[model samples]
Target: MGGGNTAEQAREVLMDAAEHLFVTRGYRASTMEVIAREAGYSRTAIYRQFANRDELVAAMVQRTTQRHMVSILSRIPAGAGPVDLLVESLVIVASELVSDPLLNTIADQTADGTIASLIANDSGLTELVKSTVETVVADGTPFRPGLHPNDLAQFIIATALSFLMKTVPAVTDPAVARSYIETFILPAILQESPEPRRVF
Candidate 1:
């Protein structure tokens, strides 16, 4: 409220309250007034930070996912090959998303297409993944000759996010998920390989 840092701290506090309400009361039912009350802020104060409930939710999602992804990416070993990086990322990211409480609440609202729209419109999420892909590719691993890092990053994001909104039978089994990535996903982005490399 006093300056940029104060306002940012206030926003984080609001987002923390919103996450609790959204997870416990469900995203569809957690209105702005409810969130404001939970955060111990007036409705007017909430509006000063976010234009609407949708905006607040989007900001929360971005913050939560960026933090989660950085943790996941850091767990991947440095200089990992393209296959290992992509495969481990897809498996681990998708698995964690399935188990997250807030994401589960969002997924439950998929009948209204909220989850789909969130994923489709989130350029921040895509850019984060793309930046990670570009950085990892600098390690001299051979991806497909004509592949663009952004394109590959998009594919991984799309695939990883699919599990967020729905139960994927194939991916429920880690081995099957690995097989799908190795068989279909890896070949699309990686250079010709007679066999998939086992990284775990």
Candidate 2:
């Protein structure tokens, strides 16, 4: 089954080509013109799809995050507890950020601070990831009741990057990583340690 590539399809094709070029060369090297030529499209067509190089990079990030999240969510074991789910999600993200070809390429090729600034400036990414995770998990799956989903989602993103940057040895042992997250991170962030009621 084949048909002419629609605008959406063309945009995806451009992203794919950009990802390859970024991996082989680098983010700075994979210019819009290069991407356009790689995708077999004109610069005008690339402009129609993305206003600028930043927009193209953002689109690639969004697509990768969505695809990776869906893949990770689909594999969660049934009856996994809240802490387990969060831990699993973070673990998968960390692993993929370092190992996945697309994400790893971005990490390696992008100039220092480029990805960080992109993440910080993307205000909607937290909500997007949180909502996507909620929609995918079964109802009543028991995410941390007290922690805001936004913070949790953002923390996952931040922590994953930290792990990638640090090359955390804990990640080498899945069981160790899970234990540490459950024992420390989950309790610290998710536990509803309410302030004791002040008695006047």
- Candidate 1 residue lDDT tens string, 1-200: 32334678879989999899888888877888888888888889889999987778778877888888778779989877667877887777555667788767666564447665776567777787788888777645778776787887788777776756544665745676677677667777767744765423
Would you give me the overall lDDT of model 1?
A: 0.74
Q: Put down candidate 2 lDDT per residue, 160-197, tens digits, no spaces.
A: 66655545665635665555556556655654422333
* Model 1, residue 56: C-alpha shift (Å): 1.9
User: Residue 14 lDDT in model 2?
Assistant: 90
Candidate 2 residues lying further than 4 Å off, grouped into runs, are: 1-4, 106-112, 133-146, 167-170, 192-200
lDDT of each: 0.74, 0.68
Q: Which clashing pairs does model 1 show?
A: none
Model 1 earns a TM-score of 0.83
lDDT of 1 at 143: 81
Q: Which candidate tops lDDT?
A: 1
